[model samples]
Target: MGTFKIEGGHQLKGSIQPQGAKNEALQILCAVLLTPEVVTINNIPDIVDVNKLIKLLGNLGVKIEKIGKGSYTFQADEVDLEYLESDAFKVDGRGLRGSIMIVGPLLARFGKGYIPKPGGDKIGRRRLDTHFEGLINLGAKFRYSKEEQFYGVEADRLKGTYMLLEEASVTGTANIVMAAVLAEGQTTIYNAACEPYLQQLCKMLNRMGAKISGVGSNMLIIDGVESLGGTDHTMLPDMIEIGSWIGLAAMTKSELTIKNVSWNDLGIIPSVFRKLGITVEKQGDDIHIPAHTNGYEIQSFIDGSILTISDAPWPGFTPDLLSIVLVVATQARGSVLIHQKMFESRLFFVDKLIDMGAKIILCDPHRATVIGHDFKSTLKAMTMTSPDIRAGISLLIAALSAKGTSTIQNIEQIDRGYENIDERLRAIGAKIERVE
Candidate 1:
């Protein structure tokens, strides 16, 4: 575990770049296993979870080469199938939730995939039922062992078919798509997740010779292909990190410019912050948020009801950014209700903000009502432990605006997503130090 010692009440100034998308990197890294040819990827985020996946791929006998900064070529010419049943794999496979995605590609290519119970942030009940059911809907045989605590899927040959998912799970959809790309027939997936990450994965698969239509829509059609080849891919910028920076600038009265933020892909993120009365200026591909020393104000709905910010699927505000919204609202002029619909326990971290002198009502496990302090009362610094990745970043933003020095422990959760976060904040004039 590491700690971040931060001196608060400093107005940050200057530009910072958001790292490559963490979610997309996980999918793209798993996609490399679909093909035996060389697949080159750029803009890979240097984060803990992603590095763990890359190491797992290497251990699986995939030839990985770092061609440049944030660029790598993966060639899966040979894979050790026996490693999946090894003790070392059971430990490494459970390190992150994204590790489960490899099953689809492995099953598609080799007719078998195995994973121990994947472990990640305890945000909510993130079920793997969708992944297993989707694969089972195809020709795959799925089995689980309670004593061994592992899941295994095998198919002599996968035959694609039409199926409506129980939910439009992003990872589930990606897993199924990876499996279906090499099946015998056409696979039509309705109510599929159409996020940019999925769209990127579909495009990369298409570039690798798989025929997938409906790139940006809920309906996806994938035609079976014999084999996939190599292709070059570059990941989009981290939209969650961009939103985090926007909130950080407003809460800390900082003038910050986030460079190359991929404005088109950031659906409803900027507008959601604007609804909270935060100023977001678009300069081509960058976003510039001026200092907010005067404090931000929350806007009421058209009917004049209290503002309520909730998370939904794509084109809806991401559940990942709700924590940042909740933290930023602590300094706004009016009260707003943050409803984290996707995750149940994500709102529990508001107690830390309440301890910092912010007025927040934890209505339940899913929602929090934030009564903005309006900068009239300064938040007192305090020591806190980060509960998860998003909550950790939210606490970091709050600490940047606090009255005195603060320490945040268990920052490994934050490191699992953001790349060199302490160093990046320091480059933007934030008084943050990473202490071991």
Candidate 2:
């Protein structure tokens, strides 16, 4: 496993362009199976998850051409159905939950799809009920083996219908949309996850001839068509990364410029950050942080009371970045409550920060009250292991902003999200190095 050795207490300067959204790119890659013609995709992230998905596609007989750096042409015109039954496919399928999306397109195009239990962050009970529930609404039958941990899906001309999802699941929504776009008749998805990633998926499907409305809201209306034509599209910039950079620039007092950020797509991020006293400047599609004067202050209520930051469904604060926000608040002033309503174990990493001398109260599994920047004189470095992707990056941010050196093992977790993180931080004057 590769590890990152970071020397803390440094100001990061220089501009870093955000990579394509890893979440969106993964689904887009799966959407290549919707058509048999060549589909060109641009702004692909050079990350581990994307690489695995590409390999999975190539195994299924899709032709991938490197038209240019960070650009590719995909043709699933000759996809072999037998490849779906291979152990190689299932092994890679177990790598991430995003792989579950292939079941929809393959079933739509070839009448059958096979997938193992999807794998991703072990944050909490992330159920596939939404995906299966939505697929069932379209007349697809699911067969699975609890012992073998395998799933087989088959259908002949899926018929769409109105369905209400149990919860707003991101991948579940994308998978259902992928399946519904090729099914016959119209499919109206209520309580849909209309996050930017899902919106990008909708736009891509619309470009490919699927009728979808309510791009940024909870209710999504999709008109199922007989086929989807191949089209060229670029994945949007990673807003989650942009938010992380905003948090990092504020905490470390770095004058960093995040380029190519879709500023208009930041629906609730800016307001969310401003509540924490972080001002983001829009410099022509770029977000600049002017060393965030006075670091970050936890803004309280009108009557001088601490505030609570929590997560909800779409149009609300994202649950993924709450860990980063919690970590950043540790370095800010005042006490604030972090209610991670989505995941149970996400905030468990705060104990590591407390070991580093930060003041915090772990109210329970899902809630914590943090009293910030009590100026624990110094944070001594230690050897630690990464838990998950977001929490891993949060720990990295905390370590970088702390004093002394720290060694973080299992950087593969962080690699799943952030691209060339160590190199990027090094360019921004951070004392960080990656070693195998």
Candidate 1 per-residue lDDT, tens place, 21-89, comes to: 999999999999999999999999999999999999999999999999999999999999999999999
**CA-lDDT, candidates in order:** 0.94, 0.86
Least well predicted 10-residue stretch by lDDT in candidate 2: 374-383
**Candidate 1, which segments miss by more than 4 Å at Cα?**
none
* C-alpha TM-score for every candidate: 0.99, 0.97
**Cα RMSD (angstroms) for every candidate in the order listed:** 0.6, 1.4
Candidate 2 TM-score, true structure as reference: 0.97
How well is each residue in 273-372 modelled by candidate 2, as lDDT tens digits? Answer: 7888777888998988888656677899899878999988778888888988888788776888999998998888888888877788999999999888
Best by TM-score: 1
Q: After superposition, how far is residue 254 of candidate 1 from its true place, in Å?
A: 0.8
